[model samples]
Target chain A: GGIITQTPKFLIGQEGQKLTLKCQQNFNHDTMYWYRQDSGKGLRLIYYSITENDLQKGDLSEGYDASREKKSSFSLTVTSAQKNEMAVFLCASSIPQGTGNTLYFGEGSRLIVV
Target chain B: GDSVTQTEGLVTVTEGLPVKLNCTYQTTYLTIAFFWYVQYLNEAPQVLLKSSTDNKRTEHQGFHATLHKSSSSFHLQKSSAQLSDSALYYCALSEPSGSWQLIFGSGTQLTVMP
Candidate 1:
């Protein structure tokens, strides 16, 4: 049983400030993803990486950037924080299998923009 | 484009009563899987149930869901609700034949009261 760890449980940033969230997984999974969770909007995919150094954009990728530095780590960066924006960013990893990939998520990092 | 829809944004139920959470989806892929994820307070979301077989039921932790391809629905159900069952539930779609990304629904917050 491996674990996914996300750093900085809470991040308070000012408007237009740049913030970065980091995730590390010990599952040795080949795929990693970053998702944004809003109060009523649910989880929206920002970016995903199928392998190390690979990146793919999702529906909510406009304001975010993602990096898959290695097989065990994935990171997300908020380009420019919006005023009064508050959301939780989640990081997940999965390894594809015959049945399907079951994502394992980190606790999440809450971003609060003032 | 793939998308998931969870009809209820919030549901309050008395303990020991039957509970149901509706989930529907739209997808272009023929072969796909549906997942029910539960998120406890301040905890990461975890898979509660998953099904790829059409018209077949999958269950975990006393929660069950059946994937009905004809209706594009995978609704979660439980015969008895417990106070500990209160949490946020998300319905997700995954195309195993394609990328490893999961498209999530708006999510439903279930508050089981004693």
Candidate 2:
């Protein structure tokens, strides 16, 4: 019965600007992840935190930064916004129960760069 | 590199008919696990099913998927289509014994017609 909440349902940023997205989970999960999804494309992992203060880069982490300040919160920062870089950013949390445990996700934050 | 491929970008079927979505993967592990994730409009992705045992069909909400290790495929199937089933479906892969990280496919959009 846990819920994940992402702040700012929509965001508009200019090129070279920096933006941040926040996520919170009441599940008290130990693992959290951030992903970017473009239209008609598969979601690409940006970063993940297995525990508080621990961060791991995914394939597409060069332009993004993430922080796990506590067990319930994870934040993602766009280092520099790129023009026409519109995508949805998703936050997910999972309990440590191996695979098939199901990942709980937030509604996501939609970013539009101009 | 672990990867997932969903052959169809979109699938359309009449309600009350059977439906299937194809998913394939490439991985070094002979027993790589596969997952089906469903994303409704304006919502985050949710796990529909996940399994690694070959030939054993995993079912959820009347949806089923069987992992075929030899072919590296885990195709989702349903006996009857419903309008509510329309959504974006993603196939994912993960090593059964190695990492908890998941690699996702491009995804398929399912549309059930009345």
Candidate 3:
């Protein structure tokens, strides 16, 4: 079995500051995704990478940037933080991307913007 | 735009009782697929079950959900509730024939009390 690791299990950032989050997986999956989960809200996709250096914007990609530095790593950057923002950012990987599919996720990185 | 709707935000149940969480989705695609994901405290959301076939029941970890294409719904259910079942549940949808990006609904917090 493989595991997905997200760096800095918790993050505290200042408003208007830039925050970066990193994820790495040992499963060698082809698709990697970053999602944001606000309190009481559904998980929203921020960005996704089909392969190394490939990037696709999701519905909630505004104010965020993502990168697939390599096949095993995906990174997200919060362009500007919100003073009261509090959410969990999840990193997931799939062998391939499509329906009739399952995803594996990292433990997640909790962010608290001050 | 693709979207998912979860009717309730919280569902509390007593142990040994039946459980159900309503989920519905809307999309402008021909072939649709649905998913139910569960998230435990401080953990990443995990896929519980998935279905795309109309009226077909999908089951896992004692939970079941059926995709009703005509109604644009895929509600989660279980025969009996247990303490371990307590968690936040999310509903998501994707169009099989189009992009495989998942659109998720606002999650429901389920507390199965003993």
Candidate 4:
């Protein structure tokens, strides 16, 4: 059994300020991902890392940056926070399945921009 | 671009009632796989079921979903609903040949009332 831990469960940031969210997984999975969750919009992938130091962009990676400095940790930075923006950020890790992978997610970090 | 669509935003059912959540998807690749993920309140999402074989029903924890390749659909269903079943459900698509990414749809929130 392993766990994914996301720091700062609640985040409050000022408009235009840069905000960072961190994640750590003990599963020793090779793939890590960051996703943004908004009300009624489900989850949107922002960035993913296949292994240490590897990065890939997803549909909503425009205002975000991610880094996989170590295999156990992945970090996401909001380049510029938008006014009145509120969303939950989720971090996940997975082991490759036959053709697809099953993801294990963190509790999530909520970002509130004022 | 590959995408998934979950038609229902919210589904409320009484205890012991049948439950169903509709999901549809589109992809250009020849091989396609689908997954159903469940998210409980304030918790991370977890894979509930997955299938790639057409018309073969996959079940887990009393939940079942069948992937219909011809219709580009993989709808989640359960014979009986329970209070513990209340959660947010997401449908996702993956085409390993195209990309090792999982595309998700807007989630359906199911509230199984007692």
Candidate No. with top DockQ: 1
| Fnat of each candidate | 0.75, 0.57, 0.65, 0.73
Rank order by DockQ, top first? 1, 4, 3, 2
For candidate 3, give the DockQ.
0.67
DockQ, per model, reads 0.77, 0.62, 0.67, 0.76
lDDT tens digits, residue span B16-97, model 3: 9999999988888877678898999988788899887888888999999989888888999999999999999998887653
Q: Please give each candidate's TM-score.
A: 0.96, 0.95, 0.95, 0.97
Native contacts recovered by model 3: 0.65
- Model 2: residues >4 Å from true position, as ranges? A99-101, B96-98
Worst 10 residues of 4 chain A by lDDT: A78-87
Ranking by lDDT: 4, 1, 2, 3
lDDT of 2 by residue, A5-57 (tens): 99988989999999999999999888899989986779898998888999999
Question: What's the TM-score of chain A alone for every prediction?
Answer: 0.95, 0.94, 0.94, 0.97
Which residue pairs show collisions in model 2? none
* Model 4 global lDDT (CA atoms, 0 to 1): 0.91
CA displacement after TM-score superposition, residue A30 of candidate 3 (Å): 0.8
Name the candidate, 1 or 4, with the larger DockQ value.
1
Instruction: Give the lowest summed-lDDT range of ten residues in model 1 chain A.
Output: A92-101
Per-model lDDT? 0.90, 0.87, 0.87, 0.91
CA displacement after TM-score superposition, residue A82 of candidate 2 (Å) = 0.8
> Candidate 1, residues B1-114: lDDT per residue as tens digits?
668989899999999999999999998888888889999999999999988999888889899999999999999999999999999999999875447578889999999999
Which runs in model 3 stand beyond 4 Å of their true positions? B96-98
TM-score comparison, 1 vs 2, better candidate: 1
Docking class of 1: medium
